[model samples]
Target: MTLKPLADRVVVKMVESEETTKSGIVLPGSAKEKPQMAEVIAVGPGTVVDGKEVKMEVKVGDKVIISKYAGTEVKFDGQEYTILKQSDILAIVE
Candidate 1:
């Protein structure tokens, strides 16, 4: 199964968090923070939302930074994904 976003929403998969710090110190799983970076899995067509035209600026396979607490989490086939509005995306990583 696949996730298809509607309106100006987007579906993203979280990038794995690093287990080691810059100093090469291995941190425990309990010390890891939620990853803010993600890879775009699916994109929604640009649509008018809240009386304003929302255009999709990102596409599938693009890496992006999103608000830390944004999006709804869903689990499918034992994999987790986030579904959120395009506006929730902060920037597209080049």
Candidate 2:
């Protein structure tokens, strides 16, 4: 199934975090921090939200950094995803 966000919402899939540190120490899954980076899966059209004009700056396939603890988690067809408002996205990775 495909996801289509509406009104400045965004759908993203988390990118896997590295298993080892730069020092070559392998970290277990329980020790890994939650990944804050994700790839844009879908974007909503620009819309007026909270009495302000909100525009979507990211598009599908864009890599983005989001605020920690932001967005709602979802599971679809054995895959996980996050749905958040465009404002919750911190930056678009170049």
Candidate 3:
């Protein structure tokens, strides 16, 4: 199943954090924190500002690093997706 964001919303697939510690010690499954970095899966066309449509800054396939505590988490059809405003994006990864 495919999902699309609406308005100024964006969808990101979170990238998994480190599986092992710096000492090369493998961490347990339950020890991982949700990564803040993710790849942009889809994006809304644009947002309306002052009755004018503004183009989105990021595009599909752009890797982004977001804030640790940002956006709303949503699940659809057993798949997880993050719904964040375009302004919530911290930076675009090269």
Candidate 4:
């Protein structure tokens, strides 16, 4: 399925967290944490600021790191998606 983000909205698919610990330890399914990183799937044209349309700095396919507590949770077609404003985006991965 394809989706188009509208004005000031961005679509991100969360990156999966590792199931195993770095210290050569394994974690149970219940002990794992949700990954805070994601790749940008889609973004709105731009945000309106002071009656002007300001183009966004990020684009599709950019790996991004966002705040762990940002954005609104949403679901579509059995898949989870997060809708966030440009301000909520913390950094763009190189």
lDDT of 4 by residue, 1-94 (tens): 7778888888898876556657888765456666778888889888788998877888889888888878877798998888888778899889
In terms of lDDT, the best-performing candidate is: 1
Q: Which residue runs does candidate 4 get wrong by more than 4 Å?
A: 19-30, 51-53
lDDT string for model 2 (1-94, tens) is 7888888899999987657779999886557788888999999887996798987889899999999989899998899999999889999989
Off by over 4 Å in 3: 19-32, 50-53
RMSD of each: 2.0, 2.0, 2.6, 2.6
Model 1 gets an lDDT of 0.91
- lDDT scores for all predictions? 0.91, 0.89, 0.84, 0.81
What's the TM-score of every candidate structure?
A: 0.84, 0.84, 0.76, 0.76
Candidate 3 on 1-94: residue-level lDDT in tens?
A: 7778888889997877657678899976457776878889899878898998877999989989988768888888887878898888999989
Q: Which residue pairs overlap in candidate 2's backbone? A: none
Candidate 2 lDDT score relative to the true structure: 0.89
Model 2: CA > 4 A from native: 19-22, 26-30
Ranking by lDDT: 1, 2, 3, 4
Q: Evaluate model 3: give its lDDT.
A: 0.84
* Runs off by more than 4 Å, candidate 1: 19-30
